[model samples]
Target: MGWWKKKKSRAVVKEQTWDRDQWRGEKILEALIQCCDGKPNSIKFFTADQILKATQKHFCKFVFPNYIFMGNGTLDNHRMILLRKMKGRSPHPPRDICTGPPKDVAISSMVSDHKNFMKLVGCCFEFEYPVIVYYGGERQYSPVDLNKIVSWRRRMKIAEEVATALAYLHVAFPRPFVYRNMGLKNILLDKNGVAKLNDLSYCVSIPKGETHVKLTWAGKDYDYMDNDYIFNRVVSEKTDVFGFGVFMQKLLTGEENFEELCGWKNWREKNKFPKWLSSYMGEGRMGEIVDPKMVLEEEERCLMEAFLVLSERCIGLRGEVPKMVEVAKELRRSLKQGE
Candidate 1:
C-alpha cells in the first residue's frame, strides 16, 4: 500500500512537470506563430524541450526553407538566434550598431569560401540582435550525441575530412581564416558520412602574412589551442593546429578534458612520444590505445600510425607545426595509403 501511494505521488509530480513543460512549449509555439505573421509557411515547430533533447539547447527549431532558426522567443528582447543562411547574403545578420560585427559574418565568410561549411541562412533584424535562420541539414543525422560510438576508422575519416575543410579555410580563402571555436561538438557528420564544421562565431580572418592575431576573448575551444593562445592571448593558424591536435587526442585517448592532455604537450615540448604509441606503431599493440569500440584491424594500423604522427605535428610549436595545407596533404596521404 505504501509503494502504491509513492508511485501515485510520483505519477502526479511527473504529470505536473509535463504540464509545465507543455505550457512552456505552447508559449514558444505562440512566438513562432507571431514571427511567421500568423502563417509560418512550410515551417516545422519543435518544442523547446524537444529541441533540447535533440540539440541540447534551449532553442526550438524554426526550420524553414534553407534555414534552421534556433532561438528562445520571437521578440526583440529575446535571446540571440544563430542563423546559417545561404550564400552571397549581406555580411552578418542584422544587429544594433553597438554590438560590434554580427557573428553570422564568420559563418558567411566560411560557406562563401567552401561548401564543406554549414551555410548561414540569414537573420531577421526585427529584434535587437536579429533572429537568424541557418541552412538545413539532417538534424536526426547529427553524429555528436549518438548512443553507440562507431569505429575509430569512421571517426578518423570524419576528422580527416574536417582537416581538409579547415585547410581550405586557412589556405584557399583570399584572406586566411582562423577558426576559433573548434571542437567535436561543432563537427557534425551527416547521414552521408561527410563532415560539416559549424559554429563560426569566433572565427576571424586575418591578413595573409600575419603570424598571429590578438584576441579580445578566448573561447572554451581554446582548450584545443596551444599554450601560446591560452596563456599569452595570441591566436594564429598554429592555435588552430593545437586545437586539431586536441581533437585527435580525444579520439585516441578518450580524454574529454584538455587538462588531461599533459602527454601530448609534454611530447611536443620534450619530443618524448608516448611509449604506448610507439609500441602500437612497432609492436602491433593497437588494441591497447585505440577505442574499444573500434577493432583497429591489421590492415588499418598503418593509417592509424600515420594519423597519430600527423596529429602530433599539429600540436607542435609554430616552427614545427605544418601549415593547414600541409596537414591536409598528410591526411590525404594517410587516406590514400590506407586505401
Candidate 2:
C-alpha cells in the first residue's frame, strides 16, 4: 500500500486502541496547544486551583450543574478554557441495546449509533471529568468589530458564520439538537465581533423514539423585564426560533419591550408585542425603531428592514416557528436583495 494509505491505516488503529481513561485530559491539552499553535507548555498539567487563581479577578462564579471547570489561562493575550469532562446526565439501560451474532460486533455497532452526545474540541473520555479547552477573550457588549457592524460585507460574513455554526448544531448527524438558552450572553463574540454560539448546557436532542417534542413558554419576561427569559414550557427547535426573533428585535430597536409584548394584559389589550417595530412599520418610523448607535444609510436601512421582517416572522411562530435553516435561508435571500 502507498504511504498515505499506510498512514490512514495506522490512524484508524490508533483511534481504535485509544484508551478512554486518558481521553479527556490529553485531548484538552492538545486542543489548548493547537489554539496557541506555538506556545510551549510552561506547565504540563493544569490544576483547578491554578486556573481559579489565574482568573480570580474575573471568573464569574456561576457554575452550571453537570459541567465542571478544568482550567483557564492566557496565551498570546487570548483567554483559554479547559472545561470538565462532558457526559450525559441520563443513563441508557443495557436492555436498550439489540443483540447481534458477535458480541464485539454488537458492542461496536451499538456505540457507533449511540444517541447521547458529548461535544468537546478534542478527545473523549479523558478521565471521568471531561476536559474541553478552547480560546476566547472576555465578553463585551460593544460591537467592536466595525467590520462586523458598520460594513455590509463584514456583517454578512458574521451572519453567515453564525448561521453556519447554528446549522451545525441544529443539523448534526443522526439527530438534530436544540439549544434551550439561545441568547446574547450565550453567543460569544470573537475579537472580530463574529458571534459563536456557546453555553450548550441547555441543549437537547430529539429522542430516538419520539416524533414531536412538547413546548411551553412562561409569559415573556419575569419580574417586568423585556429580557427573553422564558420558562414553564416544553421546548423544541421552534422555541429556538422564537428566541432568535427576540434577539433580532433587540438588535433592531436597542430597546427592551418584552414585558409589554409578552404581558397578557398589555399584549391582548393593545397588541403591545414588537412594541417599537409595530410603530415603525405602521408609520414609516424606521428611525424610531432602529438602533441609535447603528446609523444606517439608505441601503443599510433596507437590509435592516428586511431582517426586521424576518425577525417578525420568527417571533410570530409563538410555539410554531419555522426551522432555523429555513429562517436562515430566508434571511440570506432578503440580505441578497437588500445588497
Using lDDT as the measure, the top candidate is 1
Per-residue CA lDDT of candidate 1, range 132-216, in tens? 3444433323535323455666667777777887787687646566776677767765557778776554566665577767765
RMSD of each: 12.5, 14.0
Off by over 4 Å in 1: 1-101, 109-113, 127-130, 137-149, 255-285, 317-319
TM-score to native of every candidate shown:
0.62, 0.53
Candidate 2 residue-wise lDDT, 1-339, digit = tens: 111123445356446435633443443344334322344333234333343344552434334333333235443244554343333322121121111111111111212222221122222231223333333335322322332354544454455455555555566535555555555444444444556555443444555556335443333332222234343345455656666676676556543433334343566466554343554565567776665556466777777767777776776633445678887787677667766
Q: Which candidate is the best by TM-score?
A: 1
Candidate 1, number of clashes: 12
Query: How much lDDT does candidate 1 score?
Result: 0.54
The models' CA-based lDDT, in order, is 0.54, 0.45
Among all windows of 10 consecutive residues in model 2, the one with the lowest summed lDDT is 93-102
Off by over 4 Å in 2: 1-46, 49-132, 136-160, 209-211, 214-232, 256-276, 317-320, 336-339
TM-score of 2: 0.53
